[model samples]
Target: MAEENFETGDAGASQTFPQQCSSLRKNGYVCMKNRACKIVEMSTSKTGKHGHAKVHLVGIDLFSGKKHEDICPSTHNMLVPHVKRKDYLLVEIENDGSLSLMEDDGHLKTDLNCPNNELGKEIKDRYENGEVLTLTVMTAMDEEQVVGYKLDNK
Candidate 1:
């Protein structure tokens, strides 16, 4: 069998191999239905005679908060997606609630949605108070989202 290779970073040092459904744990990242999600729960069971053990998984989309579930044989392999978190400085908040962020390397991201959560509210408050805030951007499966934020005291 040809070994499947997975890249974990730009350095090409870290790698991940295919994981069995039965081996996945809650909070672990997995690729299901062509989307990257974080495992929320896992269950396993064996039915009547001649039935193979199956694993049931409940996952939430890492970026979108959407729920997904799947059932597979315990021996089935699942892809584990690579997730990256980046920090960006909040540059502006448009009138429509969209955000503008600047990366440390000077890249600008505009028209990004401010997440609708407590952290999002906090970031907005800080921005309204004229405080500089830095945001945590999460990327997975070619999707990007603002997941967290912190004040930039400098």
Candidate 2:
């Protein structure tokens, strides 16, 4: 199959392709209402006497933890966002408190915003201590955020 390219805020980077609702499973990543969410539960009801069977999907926003649901016929298609987790090295902290990340391949990303969570606080602490750290970046639909971090033993 031909590969599809997705805009990852970069000029021309290839990402994931769309998928059908039936193809998604629990914990799968999907794009709903322009937000990236993780499926928490999924169910299918039997076909009614005069209608098609329905698929019920419940998901939580990956970044906001907000619950969202959608009900559609089994044959309906859904946008499965191309979710990517990339590791970046913390190279600098900008004046505005944003982060400067360097990809494994040495590409610099300067506009990354740190999440407001416990993990985000820990990452900031490590950075202040002059310790090397690796950040896990989650990107979908051209939007990117730091989801996790770890000490860089290297």
How close is every model to the real structure, measured as TM-score?
Answer: 0.77, 0.83
lDDT of 2 at 136: 93
Query: Where is model 1 poorest over a 10-residue stretch in terms of lDDT?
Result: 8-17
Best by TM-score: 2
Root-mean-square deviation per candidate:
6.0, 4.9
Candidate 2 colliding pairs: none
| Candidate 1 deviant stretches above 4 angstroms | 1-17, 46-48
lDDT of 2 by residue, 40-96 (tens): 999999998867788899999977889999897877788787787899988987667
- Please provide, for model 1 over 10-129, each residue's C-alpha lDDT reduced to its tens digit, 9 standing for 90 to 100: 665332348888888999988878788999999899864767688899999887789999988888898888788989899999878899899788979895788888878888898999
lDDT of 1: 0.84
